[model samples]
Target: MADPTSLLPQPNREEDPETPSNNLHHSLDQIIEQSEASFGWNQFLQSILVSLASLFDGTQTFISVYTDATPTWHCTSGTTTCNSSSDICDLSTSDWAWDSISSKTIISDWNLQCSSSFITGLPASSYFMGGVIGGLLLGTLADSSLGRKRLLVISCITMSVAAFATIFSTNVWIYSALRFVSGIGRSCISTCVLVLLMERVGRKWRPRVGIMQFFFFTLGFLSLPAIAYINRANSWRALYLCTSIPAMLYCFLLQFFVKESPRWLFMNGRGEEAIAILKKSALSNPNSEFNSVLLSADLLSQVPESTKSIDPYKSMKDLFAKKWAMKRTLIVMVLGFGIGMVYYGMPLGVGNLGFNIYLSVMFNALLEIPSYPLTLIILEKWSRKLSVLWFCLVSGICGVVCAVVGDKQKVIRIVLELASFFCSRTAWNLISMFTVELFPTCVRNSATSLLRQSYILSAVFSSMLVSVGSSNGFLSYGVFGVAIFVSGFFVAFLPDTRGGTLCDTMDEQERKESMILG
Candidate 1:
């Protein structure tokens, strides 16, 4: 076991005699690296706010399933036979008896059963495609001009407005267009929240903090079935309002509740403000001693005196400037594209299995509860590379199994789907953390945003495939199986990031592997 005392700075190590000041001479990350020990109240407070954003992300991610659901239908008394395989609405509602008392979904409300496939999948696909465009355009601002707090606030408010507008969508064209706008506006929420949450704590607490955010996200996903079930027979507008109202309220609460990160502030040369925040943190956790003067001096040495002059695009450009950095990003992006198909496709395709759609969605969401805790365990004790690789391979097999299970055996098919969901969730959760660690603090947001965009881009194509292949098991899960397994094989080429300190700058990240080897 490592010595507990080594975590703290030792007075005897080397005293740099003060010429005119008495202060610890280390960088901002160095100070946290040496001094941070426990998960403090300040970090906990920040996490509550960040995890709330994750809840919103989870809500937005699968909200389309509810709002755009293909509604339950029945045929009128002697008009025509109720053949589900064909459009039941083709016969005018006047001839066919309307089964339901109200409009159950956009699909039913607009009589889209006879609509083209592209038109049917447009809303969800456009939302994802918009995410790809939005993340690339706005996500960089978090690492540069806007900082994490403002970006999160903006994203939440944007999603709320879009959800509100969607309640009054006049046509499919209008609804699909608004979803694209919402996707672009709220695209930075997950990436910004993840980065801001981690920056609030020391490296030792990062894995725990990350898992905690995911736990909140899983809870959000679980809430959907309950909300949707309650309004299942009612107009889909009701579900949209339920999710939107709370999200709008959360945006307002953010102003009074959230604080900007001291690390980000200091890194940008806002030393005095950073010191003020650190003092608040020091008080919040009385056990941790914070020497503000010493920390401020360290901050001054690292950040240029004039932070205002820094280029806004510097962080984005830095991502491509280094060969290793570029390679690392490209390889991980390829893997993310594969994971994306399964991650988003699983729950969306659950209803296509000819089972009870509500029950199937709930069952899939249930597995996420255990998956996140299990992810925390793997992150702490196992090789991060192996964790991702093995989980991917296992999930792939589960997907293929799901494809082979006959529709007659619904229970067996559901079991394989749940197994596939479990493995995929674990792998995706770990991949989020692994990618965060692989890059430096400076461009971490941009790098992660890029990976997220890759995932969203894949979802654009995969969403269409799953929809068109709703009745064909092999086309959906089978394709997912092959893609994930291929990504798993590439994991062998990457280095294990566990058992080492997180790098705070690109230079440190570039030197990380060589230092570990030496």
Candidate 2:
């Protein structure tokens, strides 16, 4: 086989200004410069908007306000107090009235609430349950028919619309329903973006790009508080409205800038279109020699023979055909679920622990910044299995220590929480990369999405656990510790894919096996 890199277009080295190649080179340079500039600016703006979209969910902000209000119930400090005495009640003296009021607004009337009950936590947990279902349904669609770019666009638009609709909800049921829809859209967007980015970039860039996605996701976490501060006085509805605008705008912008995945095009038998895209990509490479047929051959070679005639559903069946793959799927699923439980549970659990919810979440989010760099260093310098094992073990140990501290020593608990945060973030980063590496390209997105649904599902369970553990001191932390410990066991099942090239198809794996034996 010829070197795949050679097939890509190379820059015209002939310096004669009169030559057609040189003229094309100059034009290509201009295009390259423009594309880079546009991509950077657009990504920056989108990052901010994405952060705002998260804030629209208002999980942290709403919990904080509802928890902190001492007098009349208001969504935030800046909210206009209900001037009508009829609307505002001093139900603290009456048990029945207090229960009624607490049901509607627990944060403002915390004295009447049963903190340790599951019912109190049902609203948030319901959203997560919706997220799980959404993830499974939409995630598969994202892997099969929609393609990553289209899935993201559609998810974002629907999420934005659902978010805005949440504002008009009069009761918890309506709010939960809208949140469920939004959760599904959010799950699809998150997974699709990962799939899209990994497919577009070269193998060498995969880990770095994977880390970059989480970095931006963490930025969304960091910015959530600030956005909440700005819209604190406004109705919670305003937050949704704010998030919707950016999502809708981005959907429009994506139509112009985002290209369909060439890999997907080829897999779907749209070979001509895929070839055209490759030609355009080659043309954009100022250092590449233009060769359309050569580029097409290289791209075509990446498509496995099995994939050529296989239906999408059949492709999924093959993913689990081998024992190693089945093991990989199970391990990834369990690990994702455990991590999701810890990650989502911590924020909501901490909120109920009577800490400053915003500050706690921000602190946790900040801890994630170091995770990507640490993962990069470990994956490059150490083994994937070792890195995952170390992170999960250490995180579980920290969780245990935190549980032992019992929130009695505020400073100690905070320090332990931060340490645990770091470990969880690192574990999650490794899991995402590891899962991506475990499957062939044909079923890569599908397998990863299915595995990730476990995470979303666990998130729902964790949220409910938060409501249950709210009143019991040390219960939530204790359970979280156990979850982290179990995650470490699951990590043992994953095969190390460190220092390996991304497998473009199952045929690549077969070839590797044959080469090893020969």
Candidate 3:
């Protein structure tokens, strides 16, 4: 493998006693020219599109399985087949039985579906736990080692392979293990897809790009129900196999087309390669006036002098040192945690509320589409703090109303559900954008990844809460409402990043502070 550091930009230098000091200036001129010839709008869009492919991979892997029947409540026929004509055996619905059946069915629809003789709900919960672990581990990997493009490609390949492997599991244990692996890949892909988009796109375009990311994600989400509805008659294994097809295609497309982020390259100190990439990018743009020397000079000027001596680890430590950093981190962390609880909790809670599970999830996901536009409008016209605060408050209040209305009042339930969906979706969109802005670029990925992990970690707790709340009426929704309401208070602490330039280094922050004080 190429040296990772080689991807970053380096300053120009000359080595010889005869060389004048001006020789360094001449070299800087050439570097700037090269950098200018490299950047273009097409390169930016293409890189983002490729990175976003992982989002589709995640959606496919996540929603393939659905609840059908319970193990203890099985129909007595000694025969396990649910769809005899399709030769698909009905797997046990007991927590263990469900996983084993889903796993085996995904592997291949055989005549006899395996039963979970010893498996239980604990194993079922393990699948989710595995997802949490996967999101954190892979998310960190994406930030630390694998550049976004490589990480995304790898995630799709592994997720596809794991999804396919799920079809062949012999028992619940194997099935659960495979799902866990798939979850890890899915989490990594999802997190990186967002991180990569935000990092690569221009500051002015981040919100719109984020909207596009989720828009495509919603496209995947919409496709899932249709796939499920169409394949409902087939064995469950067929669903896993079918969804894996897109990921395989994405893997092929990414290998040949995707480019790494220039910003990431610069940060890593691969000035030469970063310049090379910019040259390629500029050439790709028909409208661009390509000037390699000018680009090189510009880049050289921007390159920090002491970067060679700087420690990446120390950069991270500085993120929490000041009141502003500490305050932003705490607020975003709480926002993620609360959003995770509500975002995941709502769908599960709605299902338990005796509504049409499919319609509820679909409608909730559909609501997210409008949020992108709403976000764009709010971000442009309203302050970031105000936009986030308004959305959180609305969503929280609606969630509380949803809880109080109950299932008996159909009209009231429908209205509250729709309102809750809109609020929650908007809140999450703002939170994602806000988190990206809170930290400086050097440690942005690390900080965002850690905060996001807090969200995923909170999800595990939400899952447990859902399980407990399922036994009592209105408890899950009520608890979810309370959590979201509390999250709104933290939104007040978040800074307004609207109209702010991307903070590439702490010096930028210092400069801004100085200007404000002056």
Candidate 4:
């Protein structure tokens, strides 16, 4: 067993004395880390319960792929100007019609096949735009006031309500508006959930648990194809209804099964509550020999007065207040933007793959399964910086090749597209886990949310590109390749965080930095 006193800071006799609050926080960090070393059934249950949110997020996000797709059309029996090769926009409305009922998809229901790219892309763009708004406005609450569990429940419920209400939309405008609202709610689910899961586990288990969260996301994404295919003959509203109901029920499950992150509690000055939860977790694990004496009320009382108060908006302000945090934030966001462009864009743009949309999307979604384990290995065995850089490079190369090969070489184009998407997804998983490790818990969610927002912001443009690329391939695939490739180089500026201790405060982070420099 490690010496408890040695885990804490010593008295400073130098010019700059280390504050009592800092030492207390350092002791708490060490205590928490030690207690979390053994993963038990209790932690496993908690990890799974928290990860399910990603399932719904993935479901609602890609449901748009099928719900908004323009169904295949054919000419009416005797139409003079309409034929198999005819552009639907060039023919009279009466001369040609969609194979599926018009109500099956938004494109056919709203007669958007002939609409401008901007109009066709508006709903998806609005949804991503709402994510931007939600991330900026609501994300900070997790770190500062509401705490991780409450914010997660709120975000999930909000998303579910918005998604359920979308079934009532009467026009494309209303539909887009509801999607925007859903985006706001969804913007924080993955971020909060990811942070909460990481904080709950030990450093040894953190990467694996984080990857498990993505596994649920993959499960949610995989369900979309089967759900959409089953509801292909039904109205698009059926898909929303199916996805929303389960998500609302999931909110209830979260309430009953989930616990607030202990790290967030400690940071927000609820040391007693944090200790209780940690004790409970340690008790649940048979291998853990946690010392009950280490978590006394006296330890809680020693927490600095400055750390005891909750400032609801201070988290975001703190990000900009520090120069290192600011520079780190900008670099990661730029990297996130490029990965986001390809991450969300490829699934939505599966329509342009010159194959059946269902099969095309399934192929892409199926590829994501292997990427998670592969990413886990890469993170475990290699440097985060190198994994990110190479994944981006390979994804970009495949994307550009897909564009250059064109649709005529159908098999080659599809294979390259899948390869590109696969690599991008791997990079996406890496950067997300990487971002969490980069920032201290003090502003972790805020930093992650900002990264997510950057991705969503880029997705807004990706929506437009996908719409335009339905007719022009270079805009989507070619641009996606170039963007990610250029962005990958930025990883060189970031420090490798493979085995660093997770910091709980900005002060702690600064101390670690100073140690490394001197």
Best candidate (score: lDDT): 4
Per-residue CA lDDT of model 3 for 1-518, tens digit only, reads: 23222333442333222112233322332232333334466646674566457456535533622422221212334454542222224334331233233323332232223333123222234545665676555554443456566777877787778877877776556776776777666655655666666665555556766566666766776677677667656666677777877677778877777766556566556666656665665576454443534333444554534343454345445667766767777788788777766776666555456566567767776777787788788877787777766766776777677777755786676567677767776777777777777666666666676666666666666656665665563566666667777877787766566755455565555555555445
Q: Write the per-residue lDDT of candidate 2 for residues 1-518, one digit (tens) a residue.
A: 65443433443435222112222123322222222222233333333333333333333223323333222333222334422333334323322233223423433333424333454555566566766776666665544666667777777777767766766766655666776777777766556666666555444456665666677677656766666566555444555566566666766766666666556665665655655654565554445344534433544554323233345455456668876667788888888877776677676666654567568777887888888899888767787877777777777777677767755687777777778768877888888878887776567777777776787787777766666665563566667767877877877766676754445456655554444345
Per-residue alpha-carbon lDDT of candidate 4 for residues 1-518, written as tens digits (9 for 90 to 100): 44344634443436223222355555675566667878878888999999999999999888889888888988885956778878888888888878988898888887888889888889899999999999999999888878889989999999999999999988899999999999999999999989999989777888998998788998999999999989888999999999999999999999888999888887777767777788888886665545654544456765544343667778889999999999889989998999988888888887887788888888988999999889889888899999999999998898888878856788898888888889889998999999998888889999999999998898999989999887789899899989999999999988888866678788888887676565
Compute the lDDT for candidate 1: 0.76
Ranking by lDDT: 4, 1, 2, 3
- Give, for candidate 1, the lowest lDDT window spanning 10 residues: 16-25
TM-score of each: 0.91, 0.78, 0.77, 0.94
Consecutive 10-residue window with the lowest summed lDDT within model 4? 12-21
lDDT of 2 at 472: 65
Q: Pick the candidate with the highest TM-score.
A: 4
Between prediction 1 and prediction 2, the one with superior lDDT is 1
lDDT of each candidate versus the true structure: 0.76, 0.60, 0.59, 0.85
RMSD each, Å = 4.8, 8.6, 8.9, 3.7
Q: Model 1: runs farther than 4 Å from truth?
A: 1-26, 34-36, 78-80, 83-98, 292-301, 306-308
